[model samples]
Target chain A: MDTTQLLKGVLDVAVLAVIQEEDGYGYDIVRRLRAAGLKEVGDASVYGTLRRLYTAGALSTYVVPSDGGPHRKYYGINTEGRTMLAEQRASWTRFANTVSLLLTEQHQPTATIRTIGDKS
Target chain B: MSTTTSPTLAIHDFAAAVRAALSDLPSEDVEELTDGLEADLTEQAEDLDAQSFDPGDAVGYADELRAAAGLPVRGKPRLPSAWTANKLRTWASAQRSNLTRKARSTAIGSRTLDFFISLRPFWWVLRGWAVYKVIAALVIGNSIASTLPSSGTEWVLLLLFVTVSVQWGRGRWLPWSWLPPFRTLVSVCSIIALPLLLVLATAWSSSADQYVEDYVPQGLLLDGNQVSNVFAYDSDGQPLTGVQLFDQDGKPLTTVGDPNATPWVTTYAADGTEVILVPSSDVPGRTGWNVFPLNTVDSVDYYSQPSGEPDLSTTTPAVPPFTQVRPLTQQTPSPTAPPTPVPSSAPPVAPEPSATPTPNSGGDK
Candidate 1:
C-alpha cells in the first residue's frame, strides 16, 4: 500500500499524537516529525492537519507572546484526542502484527525451495 | 555584523518565509502556521547567535532547515472555503426569486392597473406644485368659458393658452425655442386683438335690429315695462334666456314676467328693445292673453327701476341687434270698467257714460 495515501487518513491522528507528547508550535511539530522519519510530509500538509484537528475539537490551542517576533500559537491534545490516539495506536499494532504473520507464512515456501535446490 | 541584524526584522523574514511556503493552504491554516513558526524561529535564531555563529554558515543552515521543512521559497495564493461557495449560491437564488416575483406582478394582463399603480411612485416624485398649477389652469379655463357669452369662448381659450405657456416658461419644462415664440403669439392675441374683435362683433350684430314676437311671463317685468323671460330650457334644465339687459356695471336687469303664468306676451320693438307681460284678460275665445308689438313702443307699458343690474362698462352683449328690456314693476289696468252683475229677472242697467273709459277696472259700479 502507498504510505502517502495512508498518511492522509492518519495525519490528524499523527498531529494529535505529537501534541500529546508535549504541546508544540506548528514549525516545532514539523521539525519533530522530520526527526522521527516522516521526512516526506510537507509543511503545508502538517499545518493543514493541525488546523483540521483543531477544528474537529481534538486539539486545543493557546497563544504565547514572543519578545523577538510575532505571537506563537501552541496546540495540545485534549481528552478526546488522547483516547482516539490510544485506539489508533492499538489498531495499528494489531494490523501490523497480522500482516507480519501472513508474510512469514508466505516466506516458508521460498525457504523450502532454497533448501531443496541449493543443498547448502 | 550579527549584532547589527535586528531580531524583529529577522523574525519578520522568517515568518514571511514560512507564510510563502504554506500560502497554498487554506488562509486560516496558513495564518495559524505562520504565527506558530515565527515565534519558534526567532527563539532558535537568538540562541544560535548567542553561541558565536558565523553569518555565512547561518544562511546555509537556515536554507537547509527551510528545505527540510518542505516550505515553498515564495508565498502562494490562498483558496476560498466551502462556506463561501455555498453562500454565493444562496445569494443568487434569492435574487432570482425577487426578479420572478416582480415579473409576475407586472405581466401584460395587469398592465392597465399596473400603469395606474406605477403612477403613485412618480406622483410623489414629481414637483407637486407644477401638477397642481396645470389642473388649476384647466379648471379656470373651463369656468371662464362657461361664464362668458358664446362669442367669448375663443378669447377664454386664448387666455388659457397664454396662462399655460407662461407657467411652462417659469417651470422651464420646454426649450426656449418652442416656448418663447408660442407664448408671444398667444399674448399678442389675448391682450391686443381678441378684445377688439369682440367689440367689432358686438357693434356689427347690434346694427341690424331684428324683432321676434313671443309670449313672455308677467313676473319677468323689470321697472314698469321692460321684462325678460325664457323661451326655452337648456339641457341642464336651466332657463336659456339670451336676452339680458343690464345697467352700466354689467349686472343683469330684473325680469317682470311671472315664470309660472300662462299665455305670456313678449314683444321686441323695431329698435330691438323688448317687453314681456301676462295679461289679465284675453280676447274673445282666447284662453289667455298673448301679444307682441308690431313696431317700437313709444313708451314702456309701465314705469319702474331696472333689476338684476350688471357692470356693463367692460362687458359687450353677444347679439347687439336686440334690446334687452329693463324690468317692469307693475301691470297696466284695462282702459274701461268691467261689466256689472245683473239680477236674474231684471234687464241689466245701462253703464254710466263715465264708466266706459276704463275697461276691466272691476271697481266701477
Candidate 2:
C-alpha cells in the first residue's frame, strides 16, 4: 500500500523525532528522513513541515548565516515536541503489535481443531 | 561549476510565485516559509539530478505551507475589519445593491419603489432617534433629556433598542411596520402646510376685518387713550422715528400723559415756538397725532409782555427768540416745556380777575 497518505498525518511526529535527536536544517532533515527509509518524503514537504512545527510552538528555530550560498535555518525540538514524540512512540508501538498479531494468526479452523484434539 | 544567471533567475521566479501565493499570510509566516529557499535551490542546482527539480505546480506549495503551519489557505484568511465597521459596510453595500437592482428593473413604478426603499433606512434611523428621545424624556424625567442619545437614559434602553434593531434587520415584522409609500410626504406637506395654515389662521382665525373700517375720523388712531411701545412711524415707505411730530402747518404738538409718556410734546421741541394742533383726522390719508414744526417766534409777541413783577427778565430766556439757531435734539425730552409754562406764570397777582392773569396766578401757585 502507498504510504504518502499515511505520511501526511504523521509528518509532525516524524519531523519532531528527526530534529529531536539533533538540530537540523530543512534540507538536512529531508535527507535524514529519506536515509532512515522514508524514501517517498518530498523535500518541500519536509521544509513545510519543519516550518509548521516551529510555528506550532513544538520546535524552536534560529537563522545561521553562511559565508556563501543560502543562510541556513535550523530547527530544534522543544519540550512540547518531546512530549508529543513520546506519545506518538507509544501509540505507534501499540498499533504495530496489534497488526503483527493479526498477520501471524492461523488461516484454517481444521488445524486449530486438530491441535485442540491432540492437546486434549 | 556555476550555473548561468538565467536558471538562477528562474529559481528566483519560482520562489516569487510561492511568496505571491502566500501574500495574505502574516509577514512572519511568509518570511519563515521562503527563508533560504533560493539558497537551497541554488545548492540543489549543482547536482545534476536535482538541478531541474522545478516545482511543477508551485502554487500548490503555498497551500502545503499553509496546511503544515495549521493556518487557513492563503486567500481565505478573514479580512481584518472591526465588527462595527464590518456591519456598517455590509448594510451599506446591501442597500446599494438593492437600489441598483431596483433601478435596473424595466417597470417605471419600480424606480419609485426603489427610491422609497432606499429612503426607508433614513426613516429607520430617524425613528430610532425620535423613539429614543421620547423614551428618554419619560424615563429620564426631564422636560428635555440630555441631548446625547447614549446619555440621560439607562443602558437598558440602549440594549432594548439594539435588540429591536437586530430583530428588525433580520426581517421581523412585529417591530417595524409597513411605512407609507410616501415616506417624505409628511415633511414635504408640512413645508407646504405652514404658509397655508398661516393663511387659514390669518383668514378666519382672527376676524381681521372686524376692527378695520372704511372710515375713521382720525388716521392711525389707537382705540385706547394710551398707546405704548410704538416703534417707528413710516414716511412713504421709509421708517422714521425721533423726528419730532409736526402738524401740517409745522408746529410741534406735545402729548401729555404719564410724566414718562414719550417726550413727543411740542414745547419739548423748542421755547417761543408757536403751535397749532391738528386733530388726527385732518391729514388726508393719515390718522395719528399731527403736530407742526417749531418756529422761533418771539414769545413777547405771542404773550403780552409780563407786568407787575419786574421779574420779567428772570422769566424770559436770555437767548432771545430772534436768534435763528436750530437746536439739535438733546437726548431727553427738551426742558423747553417747563420753561414756557414758567414764563406764562411770571405775571404778579390779579390772582382771580384777568383770565390770563389768573391762569398765570394759578400756574405760579
Candidate 3:
C-alpha cells in the first residue's frame, strides 16, 4: 500500500527514462525525478538504480570534476538502455490505459471485478 | 566556494561512515555502491545544510542503497516481524560508525585511537586472566592469590583461556562478526568483564594486605599446641590456688581458645564421674581467666546462668593433676620487694580434698 513499495518496482525504468532525456549524475537524476513530480522517490534509490543500470551495461558513466567538491559520476543511457526503456514505455502505456478504463467505468464494477478475479 | 568548504568535509565524513557501516560487503561491491557518494552527499548537504545529514541518516541511506540493489541486509537477515529489533540494530550500528567518524575527524584523536587499537592484544590477555580468576574463585573455590597461575592445572587453564581470548580478539574465533546476535553477546560479556575484573583486583589487594601485616597470636600456646587452661604447682608439690601467671615478657597468659567459643567442656574423673569444666569469674563484673586452675561450678549453677559466666558464690576451684606430686628441690626468689597482700575482693577458693581421683586441670586439652 506504500507508494515507496510501488516505486521500488519501477525505479529502474524511471532512472533510465531520466537519463535518456539527458546525462545526469546521482543527485542530478534524483532532482530531475523529484521535479518531474515523483517527489516520493529516494535519493539513494536513484543513485543505486543508476549504479545498477551502469553495471548491467545499460548505462555508461563519466566523471566531471568540480572546483570545490568531489568529482561527479554522470550516467547516460546507452543503446541497450534506450531499447529497454522503449519496451517499458509501451508496456506502461498499455497497463495504465487498462487500469484507467477499469477505474472510469463506475457502473461496470461487476464486469471489472469478474475480469480481475478471472485473471487471478 | 568559501561556503562549501565545511559542508564538503562533513560530506566526506558522512560518506566514510556509510562505507564503514557496510564494511562486511566485498571491497569491490562496496566501492561500486559508494563510488560517488561524497559528490552526491555534498550536493545534498549544500541544498539542505550539513546539519540534516546525521550519522543515522547516512547509515539509513546506505541500507536503502543496498536494498534497492537487491543485496542482503547489512547484518544477518532477521524475520520481518522483528521490526523493533531491526530498529535497535540500526541504532547501534549508527552509534558505532558515528563514534569512529568523530574519532577520525582529527589527526590527534585518530592517532590516539589507533594506538589503543594496537594494544588490544594486551587487553585480550588481561581479559583471559580475569575470566580464569573468576572461574577459580566461583567454581574451584580457590582464593584470589596471584596473577601467575599457582599449579599445573591452573597454568594450563590460564594459557588455554588466554589463547582462546586472543584468537577471539584476532577474529580467528567467532569470525561471524556480521551476525548481530553474536556481536551483542560479545559486547555484553566485555561490559560484564569490566566489573568482574574490578572485583578480582579488590580481592587480590586485600590478600596482599594480609601478607604484609604481622601475625597475631590468638591465645596461649604450649609445644605449638593450643593450651585450653593453665595449672600451676609449688616446689613442695602441693596444688596451688589463685595463682596468677604470665609469660616471660609479662603478658598475661589467657586461655588458648576463643572466649566466645562454646562454653562447656566435659571431663571424666578416674571414678568415671562425668564432670563438665566451667570457666568461673572472680570479681563481680570481670573474669580473672589468667588465674591458674580456673574456678569451676556445679552443673546446676553453670546451666542456670544463661550468660555463660559462672556464678562466683557457687563456684569451686578446679582439681589438680595429682593430690600430691613428688618433691623437687625447693627454692625461693630472694625478696626484691615486700610480699603484696592479696586483694579482699578475690573470690574464695575452697580446696576440698575429695577422694575421687583428679582429672587433667587443662580442660579439653
Candidate 4:
C-alpha cells in the first residue's frame, strides 16, 4: 500500500525529528528524510510542513546567504518542537506495537468471534 | 566546477511561476508559502544531477503546498465569463509583486518601502474620514462647514468609522474570503469619491459664504426696522442742526437705512406748513445722511435739479419734532469736583430729548 496518505499524518513529527538532530534548510531536510527511506515525500509538502512548523512556533528560522544562489533559510527545532516530538513518539510506538501484534497473528480469530464460539 | 548564474536564475523563474499560480491567495499567505522557494528549488535541481532539471507544474506544486499548510484552495469562478476579471486581477497582482521585488533590491528603496508601510495607519484613518464625510454630505445631506469634527455626535461617528476602517485594514473585521473583492470595491470607490468630495466641498463652501453675506444687517436699525434718518434736540427743546453723529467706536454713521431711498421727503413744520427734507452734504460734496437733523430743502429746488449734488444753497435747517421740550437744568458741580470743569452737562441734555421722538412716526424724528 502507498505510504503517502500515512505520511501526511506523521510528516510533522518526522520533520521535527530531522531538524531536532541538526539545523537544516528545506531541501537538506527533504534529502535527509529520503535517505532515511521515505522517498515518496513530495518537495512542496516538506516545504509547506516546514512553514507550518515555523508558524506554529515549533521551529525557528534564520537566513544564511549562499555564495552564488538565493539565501538559504535554515530551520532548527526549538523547545516546543521537542515536547511535541516526545508526545507523538510515544503515541506512534503504542500504535506500532498494536499493529505489529495484529499483523503477526493473522490466523487467529478475532476476540469477538472467539467469545461467541465459547458461548455457543 | 564553477557556479553559474543560469541555474539560480532558472530557480528564481520557477519560484515566480509558482507564486503566480497562487496569486489568487492573500498576499501574505503567498509570501509565507514561497519566501525561500528559489533556494530550495536550486538545491533540488542540484541533487537530481540533471543539468536541466524540470520544476514540473507550478499549479500542482501550489496545490500541494496549500493542502499541507492548511490554506484554503484558490476559488474558481463559476462561469466562463468571470474568468476575464480573474485574469485581469491575476495580471495586476503579478505586476505589483514584480514592482515590489525591484523596489526591495536596494537599501534606500527598502527603507522607503518601510516608511510607506508605516504610514498605512494614517492612510486608513484618512480613508475612513473621507468615507464618512462623503456619506454624510451625499446621503444624509448634512452640511459640511469644516473638515474637522465640530460636534460631539460628529466626533463619535468619526471615531466609529475610523475604528471600523482600521480593523478592516488590519484584516480582522471580516471573513478572509469576503475581504478581497470588498477591499477592491472600497479602493475603487474611494478613488472615484475623491473628486466627487472635492466638488461637494466647493459647492458647500460657496453656499456657506452666500449665507453669511445674506444675513449681515446693513446700516442702522431700531427694533428691527431701518432708522431712515436721525434727529437731535437740545436740553432747551430747540432743534439742533448740522449735528454730525459718531457711534461709541468713533465711526462716522454716514449711511442711511437704504442707499436707494428717494432723495426728497416731506415733513410738517411747527407752523403746519410742509417742508422738504434731503440728506445734508458734509465737507461740501459728500452726503452725510447719518448726520442728525437732515437738511431741509425747497421741494421745487430738489425736483428741478439734474443728477449730481443737490443745490447746497437751497438747503435749510431741519424742522424739529417740537419747538420747545421741557428745558433741562444742570446741577452745579460740587466744590470737591476737579477744577478742569468737565463738560458732563452736554451728554445729559441729549438723552432726554432723544427719548421724546418715537421712531415709528417715520423719519420725522
Which candidate comes out best when scored by lDDT?
Answer: 4
Candidate 4 or 1, higher DockQ: 4
Candidate 3 per-residue lDDT, tens place, B1-365, comes to 13434666766677888888778778888898899887776677666656555324677888888887655688886465586667667667856765675687689989999998999899888777777877777787777655566789988988997887787777776656464476456546756875766676777878778877756666666666645455565656566877877779996566634544635454444455545554546533334556777665565445567776554456666755455553454253543432222222322233322223224332223
Interface RMSD of each: 6.2, 1.6, 1.2, 1.0
lDDT of 4 by residue, B192-277 (tens): 87676667777878988899988957667777755445656566645577788888998767545453464655555434555555
lDDT tens string, model 2, B1-365? 22334667777888888889888877888888889877766665554355455555668877776776665665554655554455555566656654565465557757777688788655454444444445666677633323344543455675565455444544564533433212233334434544544454456434546556433432223553322112222322222323346457774333333222322222311223332222223233323332222111222243344542122122211221111212233553764532212223244322111213222421233
Best by TM-score: 4
TM-score of each: 0.29, 0.37, 0.37, 0.39
lDDT values of the candidates?
A: 0.48, 0.54, 0.69, 0.72
Off by over 4 Å in 3: A110-120, B1-6, B49-56, B77-365
Query: DockQ, per-model, please?
Result: 0.10, 0.35, 0.43, 0.53
lDDT of 1 by residue, A1-120 (tens): 677677666666677778888998877787787678886655546765676566545689998887865777888998756866877788878887998988987866444446535654
Q: Which segments of model 2 are wrong by more than 4 Å? A: A103-120, B1-5, B47-51, B75-365
Q: Give the per-residue lDDT of model 4 (tens digit) for A42-71.
A: 989998899888876679999899887678
lDDT per residue, candidate 1, B273-316, as tens digits? 44333322323332222221111112243344263322222321
Cα-based lDDT at residue B297, candidate 2: 21
Candidate 2 chain B lDDT trough over 10 residues, lowest sum: B316-325
True lDDT of residue B164, candidate 2: 53
For candidate 2, report its TM-score.
0.37
Tell me the lDDT of model 3 at A10: 82
TM-score of chain B of each: 0.19, 0.22, 0.36, 0.38
Off by over 4 Å in 1: A1-10, A34-44, A66-70, A109-120, B1-14, B17-29, B43-365
